[model samples]
Target: DARVTQTPRHKVTEMGQEVTMRCQPILGHNTVFWYRQTMMQGLELLAYFRNRAPLDDSGMPKDRFSAEMPDATLATLKIQPSEPRDSAVYFCASGTRGNTEAFFGQGTRLTVV
Candidate 1:
């Protein structure tokens, strides 16, 4: 059962509220990934960090979306003033350094009014 850990498996927030999602990458893993799944856009990679440093997050709304890794094991994604359009299943995955196989965690399903 080696996998990433995500908290608050589901969340319902009012529009304009802030939401934060958390993940604990597998121990010793140096790469973490975040993704979002939606009806229209399908599945898209939002951002990723290697060695706990963000490579790029252009796919996300720069003003509203943020991703960070406070340490090797923990990664976080936050949405400020959340909107209904932001409702989606957010997934967190991790892999060993330079490894291609990623282990995914049970996603956090977010709903905004």
Candidate 2:
């Protein structure tokens, strides 16, 4: 079945550690987004891409967070020197251009102690 798959469904790490999350978007979906959810911010869009090209990442902390789509099927988000404040559920979503609906992955729950 076509689906968005996210790895490392749950993670716990010390502050200052590096965290890497992976996502495999559904085949043929040309748009992708990286989002973080927390009680304070609700759902926030951290990054977005279309046709494998990065379109926006303004919501992400440029100093420590990054999002990239290295190929058509893979999208990655990395946080270096992760802090406790970064704890949240990260999600990857994909959709076709012009489609109003987006398919979301299960999400990776991260906790930095």
**Top TM-score prediction, candidate number:** 2
- List candidate 2 segments past 4 Å from native: none
Q: Residues 16-99, candidate 2: write the lDDT tens digits.
A: 999999999999999999999999999999999999999999999999998889999999999998999999999999999999
Query: Where does candidate 2 clash, by residue pair?
Result: none
**Backbone clash total, candidate 1:** 0
lDDT of 1 by residue, 1-113 (tens): 67899987999999999999999999988999999998999889999899999997877899999999998878999999899999999999999775798899999999999
The lDDT, on a scale of 0 to 1, for candidate 2 is 0.96
Candidates in order have lDDT scores of 0.93, 0.96
Q: How close to the true structure is residue 23 of candidate 1, measured as C-alpha lDDT?
A: 99
Cand. 1 TM to true fold: 0.96
Candidate 1 wrong stretches, greater than 4 Å: none
